[model samples]
Target: MSAELDPRLLTRAREVVSSITGFRDDAIANEAMERVVRGELARGRSSADLLGEMLFPQSTLSGTLVRAALVGETYFFRQPEHFRYLSQVGVPAALRRGSLALRGWSAGCATGEEAYSLAAALQASVPHGFPVEVLGTDLHEASLETARRASYGTWSRRESAPRLFPLYLDGVDRQVTILPVVRRITSFAQSNLLAPLPERFGRFDFIFCRNVLTYFSLSAREAAIALLARALNPGGLLFLGAVEADRVPAGMVREGTPELQTFRLLGPGESASPTPVPRFVERAAPPAPLIRRPMATPVPVRAQVTPPPPPARLHLEALERIEGGDVDGASAVLESLVRQAPDYLPGLLELALLRERSGAREAAVPLMRALRMRAERLPPDQLVDGPEALPARFYQASADAYLNLGALE
Candidate 1:
């Protein structure tokens, strides 16, 4: 088998993928393409024959390439604040329209976490027996099968609150499954975002397409947004990733704070309105002291008591526990250290990875964000003092976390 892939073969693979999925060549890295080429060669297929299958409109090879190249990384309650707003604001608004039925769509719903999250939110918001329907669509059949199963591991629950686990999920032997109530309202299907959505899918009152458009080419992004806008009911809401807020299409007005990353479709004869600024209640300052207390005569101060050990010590202790395979104990110690020093890079990265493994990736975001902010403020030379400091490793870990969460550009 040839280790070298022909440039023409790579170009053909890219074109086939782009035409089918609207992903650019750069979006699917060369490494992934090489893997596909090598796999075909290992199976005794020549490069020319593999290319022919890829270029064929209905060939299974094209679908295989799409699945292999496009990664689906999602967890439950990813960006919980989005679900909070959906429950508090979006659901209420849709219910207010006096329609007996409420419909929501999770486009590009990888493995059904986001779709199930939306269903859970709506279930919590609406009264019993209210007609609520949630549709989750993705391009990969394998992911759709996973969505249908509704069973997930710690990786899926990392960001999910413990309380929510008992409320909405059934956990047994380290696998947590979405409950029947959530599954009842949600359905999954194989569909491509670049292609025309099925007519039976119908219009939706709310649509979630987060962290997906960033992978698309500009023209593909525009086309997908247009299709989404057309699929939305008048005054319906669309939730996008924060990074994509600026690219919302015409006839749709951004709603809520920029942080919410929500957009609403404007009906005929309607004009876009500025999102209302949130009003925070100001707590009154405690009543001023009647008078400034005069300084007391200082007695000889007692020798200062010894201070507690620094967070770095606790971090080191946690590392020992982790090395010893007491992950739970190590996590407990790391959690305490981070609470005391949220910006401690070493502990922060360790804890974030722990949270990720435990199915709480969303919970890890702020810690990673803090680390990123700190790294950005300081130069490499100023980032560390010793091997244990590991500032460069910290920065790299932060970058990796952001990439995992789809927060990095």
Candidate 2:
């Protein structure tokens, strides 16, 4: 806390912020609030003086706080993979769906960088004569103005950022302008993600709403995601941040691998949502698991690749990745999780099976041994803690089969 910061003023600011942003953490939301308070105080505005003024939703004070709170640093092509996927996978699929034109959105576009980036990607990827449009939106008015200008300072250009396509014009002092071509296809607006985009905005082929949700409360995040999903056309894709993949959107099926964190709205003739992965739960054993590996010759032991549910978030994420076929990525997650919480039963079991599957049965032995040791100490009927709440024996049987160590008599 800054010694000069006033607690009463901070409290008032927090209330206004919570009412508006639904930000999950006060400290993060407080960042802009503290600055606003400091600025007001330096200008001879007392804490009472500021509080005395109307700070309602439409008040000047409230607007100032929101602009400050929403201002975030961004650069061109921040996450290139989304662009690559858009150009390659997304474009063709939408084309196949017979999209007359492609629509894209950069939700919570902090500055014009992402919006312009989307414009460039769509312009380059979409076929000629098709109308392509991108709408970049944020609550920060000044940032939107900067985006509308379509000019950027050097800060917007990070050396490591991938330029999958040309973004800006090559100029000197007056240089660094977004190509007139890109500017033509892109537009910026000051808009709130918490609210539904107007009907005029129309449904989109894909939407990129990354990282911004990290600032939102649980309910707010869900609302924002649902709104974004609704904005997508049937077969349209919604792209979220990598860390934001934990919550699968309602009625949307997971697309690509866990790495992609993309979801597709069910198109015509597509099966309805059966996103069975993220909602790890305790359920009766399915008639068949995901994969049943070869049994040990003598006793014909079987190892089920699908996880028994009721796992921690980390484990669920790994399982989701595995379900998406990112084996190495899942292994990395499981290894770290098991190492940190060595006694975590689901981690031990799932990671062991992965290690065994990857031809590292040598490494798998110790994990299997550790898993068996742990599960044996627990009563077979006692369910382990996880979304699925599978019994200890479920893990023990898996471990025993991998080790070819025959189940306990």
Per-residue lDDT of candidate 2, residues 1-409 (tens digit): 5566668787887777766776644313455677787888889888788786536777788778767665365788875667877887889889998889998999988878998998899889877768999999988788888889888887787644568887888677744889988898898777788899999888899899986765565667778889899899998999986434454688788865455678989876877645443222112233332466787665435855555433487887886666555676787788788877787897887786677545575787888799879987876546786534555655664554445422221
Number of clashing pairs per prediction, in order: 7, 9
Q: Which ten residues in a row have the lowest lDDT in candidate 2?
A: 278-287
Global local distance difference test of model 1: 0.71
Q: lDDT of model 2 at residue 336?
A: 80
TM-score of 2: 0.66
State the lDDT of candidate 1 residue by residue for 1-409, as single tens digits: 6566778887887787788777644555555677777888899998789877876956888777777667576777776657767777777877887767888999999899889888888788888789888999998889999999889887676522223322255578788878888888899998889887899999998899987775566678778888888889988889986444343479988766544568899888988777563322122333344466887965557966666558777876776665444667777788888788776676766686566545576787776777666655554323442213333433543444345435432
How far is 259's C-alpha from truth in model 1 (Å)? 2.0
| Winner by lDDT | 2
Q: Output the lDDT of residue 281, model 1.
A: 15
Residue-level lDDT for 130 in candidate 1: 90
Off by over 4 Å in 2: 1-6, 27-31, 273-409
User: For every candidate structure, what is the RMSD over all alpha carbons to the true structure, in angstroms?
Assistant: 10.7, 14.3
